[model samples]
Target: MTQQIRRVLVRSFEDIVIERVPAPVAQDDELLVRTTVVGVCGSDTHAAAGHHPFIDLPYRPGHEAVGVVVATGRGVGDFAPGDRVIVEPNLYCGRCPQCRSGRYNICQELKVFGCQTPGALADLFTIPARRVHRVPDGMTDLQAVLVEPLATPVHAVAKAGDLTGRTVAVLGAGPIGLLTVVAARHAGAARIAVTELLESKRARALRLGADVALPAGAPDLVDRAHEALGGPVDVVFDCVARGQSMAQATDMVAKGGHIVVVGVGAAGTTPVRLDLVQDREIRIEGTLMYTAEDYRTAMSLIASGAVDTAELVTATFPLEDAAMAFSASLDLEQVKVLVTADGAVGVDGR
Candidate 1:
């Protein structure tokens, strides 16, 4: 293996370029993973195109990565050389009140892999021994890379408990939104409606079992969804996070229905119309990143084939062509574009 590894770093928006960074080192309680497939998330697109405010300069942007363990540091348990695993990415201070209370995802000092911390786009990366989850045996690296994004929808569904027989609407039939539709179906929602700007994504959503897929700026999106399901929706998983979708979510909810906001709200969009929710006496919720349980449940869904993820992987690119991967991810026909590296050691070692 080379001492220096290439990484996709973004020093400025529209200025993302690959560079050779020194390969990461591992210490006891850490594991060195040779990354394989990395999903280009919508957040990466937003950040790389200069839409988000939280990310800083010279950042390597990829959080959804799956790879094989090449070396495990001393004291690391339950893993060894050549184990296939997906990186959990969220690093938290265990001593924080949130972490102590079992809400590590919301720990005050949390830093996500590929966000505030170094991510898995490089040839080799290291993480706390606990942050690795073994990918199921014989799983394709494509399915492995989807674990992180898949977890987001799972967590959103979990947050909105007892959704059985409830009507659901997902605004934004993008990756997360489509996943939310799948999760809602798994939760036994009576009907699922998805909306998107792209006709191609909408068509894919229909194939993935959305009862209806709406145009992004549909004049009566909420009404149309309600009418399609024969009444106001019981839950609206607003995965677009933009004000328009949030507005539609507020309108789609029934009198006592829930609204779960799943998308990353770009830098400065504040949601409003509390009076509408207050009057309707609806439950509005905001979901952040996922927990370990969410990740596990997501992988289980994939392994069980409950989720037909074939339509989800709209495109793929090799590691060296990640810039092209990112470009493809922005295409109208793409739902997700993944960057992959060869897993030469996985089959024999796992």
Candidate 2:
């Protein structure tokens, strides 16, 4: 008889529940990973509420995860049993032109592991060997879980070119927004401002390195961001990506500035003032998931003590309590919520 294990599934926001299924075995060129920790992302919550454009309903929900290898299949020699790893989650068709051009994040057949397919929110899950990165020797599960999330902002900051002494505004002080502050600061941004609805998140953004954190609903937000950064921002990392935030971005960014859309916006048209975009020559770019190089940069930053892992994770629930974890992730005061498997607690890899 096959062994049974539990995994969380989301049919809707009010319908998240744990379900048991047979444990999976590694296939060729794959590794079976036993999940240790999984971070609940803003996109996960959006998908649960049926708001995400790419992610559909009734799916396993774990993308940002840390795990240990339980088994390796044929052709997998890079990792062994007991090796710790972080899931990269972005799946791409190697034959795609985007993949051939070293931009597989936008591969024509690109599919995210947790979003478009089954993911690692279980006792055992098999993934392609190329999709998992070996965790550094002394990095804790808490820190490792952040690699996937941080890689995004790392990639976004790269799109903005060198930040050395550049002024930046990150709209939204959630996990991505707060991490954008960290990434921008690390890239040598001269000053950084953030806007969010919750005071707690604004405060957390300040602790994470923002020079100014303001209310997202402020009518004068564009001016406030300009004044806080000493002038119009040279780069605006729109972590909110809403119609209103895009408007604010266009208003606050200086002439010839760059606006990197880091957040996943809703599916539909969002109006943009093309006149302003044309007159000011603002460059608007959209960033997706990270590449292997960005993943390496994220790991290096985490290993170098650049990220405050403690400040980012607000709570953790057992694998059985994934529903509660998702609920906590939606809490206004929470920064990052995690779900952990048995024996994964207190073993911080310190």
Candidate 3:
């Protein structure tokens, strides 16, 4: 008899339902993890609503998750039944030029689990053994599950070189922005300020250690930010993923300041001001997904109590309520909304 597993998914764009999916047989060096918690991302809202490029009709939409190993394939020695882990979710083709150079997340042939394959909204998931990371000491699965997104900002901060005693400004107080603030602080920025239009998000950004949080496009935004920083900032992290914010931020940064764009932008639209970037020696670079080292750094930060992944989670719901959960995310219901595979977990329960 073919094994079956239940998955909370949409049969069609509008048909949300629980599906009896065929249980996947793991290959050697893979581990089958019984799903625990999966964080619903804002991009998941686009993919779930049929707007993402990689997703098509009817799919499970979770990428950041933590679970317990239920089974191990042949040759899988690092994990066995009952080991808790965080999922890396990225599957990069290692032979690509980007991969060989240690920038695998940009491999032209990259395939993300939720975007290109089965995701974490189901009863179980099979992933390469190396992609499963042990939950660090004293960190619960709930906190460990956020390693993916946290690592994103970690990689961006890495690209910024050194932040010791430098002023950093993060544009946008979304999930990535909020997380970036934490990482920037932990990376040694003397003062960090964030900009956002949403009042609630701005407030949350402040609570997360931002020296100040304010609206992004104010007439004197640059001057105001400098005043808040006690002078011009040395780095700007743009998580807004929009052309306007990018354009505005270019000038907000100091002459030699570095600006890193971690958010993906609309296709065919370039957000850079080439002349200014070159003439002023202002460095602006595009950052893709995190590297393996980025993940390691994220784990260390979590273990050291530097970044607060738990505080970033603002809402939760059952897996079967994925559609509603995604809708809530699209409506900005919270900083981060997670669709939990285990329904018995209360809103704030560990």
Candidate 4:
């Protein structure tokens, strides 16, 4: 008899269902994992609502996840059954020019799990061994699930070069934006200010070490940020990629400073102030997923207590209630929602 596992599937826009499917088999270079905790991301919400550009309907929508290795294929040696690990969702072909140049995150033929491929929102899944990073002993599965999302901000911050003693501004205090605050704080930034529309998120930003949390719609938002930073911010991370936010980012950045685009918006194109960018010589860069080193650093930060992800988890639902979990994630009051498999809760009862 074939093994059967429960998984979440998006049948149509706003219609999510749970179904039992055959468990996948581990290939020669793959690891069979039992999904532990899967975090609901904004992209997942978009995909469910038929807003995501790349993800098609009837998709399994989860990318940020941590699991336990249940079995390893013939060529696998490092990981064994029962080892906890975080899954890197990006899959790339090693022969691509981008991969050859050591930038696999933006590979010529890149496919993201949960978007372009089957996701880990299931009881069992198979992934390449190279994409599985071991979870440290002290880190809980709740915290481990954050490693995948946090790696993105780690990579974004690294793209801005050295941030030591620099004043930073993060626009939009979503998961990525909030994590960026932790990353900048760990990188020795002198001050960090976050702009968000939700009061709860603003407060969370402060709790996460942001020096100041300002409302995104403040009439003098740029002026207030300048005053808070003692001048124009040295770096601006536009975590809300809408046109208005991008415009605000261009205006708030200090001359010759850097602006990193980290968010994804539904709009196909947003008008930017190119004249301002050209005149001030401001550096604008876009970051995709993350590299292997970024994942390592993210795990190290979580394990070493440099970043606390537990506070970000607002709610958790059993795997059977994945649809409800996804619904809760859309609320502004919630930061992150998780779906856990059976026996995933621990002594702490999380």
Q: 1-350 in candidate 2: lDDT tens per residue? A: 55777778899989998777777789999998999999999989999999999889988989998999988999997689999999999999989889999999999999998889888777678899999999999999999999999999999999899999999999998899989898899999999999999998999999889998999999988888888888899999999998999999999999999999999998999999999999999999999999999999999999999899878999999998888998898888998899998633121111
Model 2 residue 150 lDDT? 96
lDDT winner between 1 and 4, please give it.
4
Clashing pairs in 3: none
Global local distance difference test of model 2: 0.91
In model 4, where do residues sit more than 4 Å from their true spots?
A: 343-350
Sorting all predicted structures by TM-score, with the top scorer first, yields 2, 4, 1, 3
Best by lDDT: 2
TM-score winner, 1 or 4: 4
Q: What TM-score fits each model?
A: 0.94, 0.96, 0.92, 0.95
Candidate 1: tens digits of C-alpha lDDT, residues 278-341: 8999998888788999998999888877667688887888777877887787776788888887
Off by over 4 Å in 2: 343-350
Which candidate leads the pack in TM-score? 2
Clashing pairs in 2: none
Summarize candidate 4's per-residue lDDT along 164-188 as a digit string, tens digits.
9999999999899999999999888
Point out the worst 10-residue segment of candidate 2 by lDDT: 341-350
Candidate rank order under lDDT: 2, 4, 1, 3
Question: What TM-score does model 1 achieve against the real structure?
Answer: 0.94
